[model samples]
Target: GGIITQTPKFLIGQEGQKLTLKCQQNFNHDTMYWYRQDSGKGLRLIYYSITENDLQKGDLSEGYDASREKKSSFSLTVTSAQKNEMAVFLCASSIRWGRGAETLYFGSGTRLTVL
Candidate 1:
């Protein structure tokens, strides 16, 4: 397990458009997570996959989709981009030992802009 990276530092999309974000890692951990960070609120979990080929919705899963096709990557999709919607999507990964996660590392993030 080494580093986690998110692609496209900035993402711009039109209203009602479908947007996708991607995350990649270098054989570091077991679980991956996507979180949405608003202007003021804390980072809200959007989705997570505990194992390869598994996906789970998180607190802010509405209007979004996620997939973990392999251990090295994960992706998220916005079903519909709402005008004026802007936020930072963060990608994180951790090693699951027992019931908790460790060695958690976060990517720089992908900022979304809906116009």
Candidate 2:
């Protein structure tokens, strides 16, 4: 069994400030991803890394940055926090097999609030 751990379970930021969220997984998976969740909406991929030191931008990566310095960890940063906004950042991992089935294992998440 494995688990994903996210640090700073809650984050508070001021408008225009930069905020960072971190994630670590013991799943020994080959791929790691960061997602953003808005209230009442589905998860949107922000960034993903297929392997260490590799990064790929997703649909919502415009206002964010991500890094995979190690195989078991991934980090994300919000370029500029918006005022009075709230969102959840989720970290997930999956095994890559050519072009086959993959299941995402998600972390509890880091909730962000901007003032």
Clash count for each candidate, listed in order shown: 1, 0
Q: Estimate each model's TM-score.
A: 0.93, 0.94
For candidate 1, what is the lDDT? 0.91
Error of 1 at 32 (Å): 0.1
- List lDDT for all candidates, in order: 0.91, 0.92
Task: Estimate, for each residue in 1-100, the C-alpha lDDT of model 1 and write its tens digit.
Answer: 3788898899999999999999998856788999999998999999999989889889899999998979989999999999999999999988864666
TM-score of 1: 0.93
Worst 10 residues of 2 by lDDT: 94-103
Candidate 2 regions with alpha-carbon error over 4 angstroms = 97-101
TM-score for candidate 2, residues paired by index:
0.94
Instruction: Highest TM-score: give the candidate number.
Output: 2
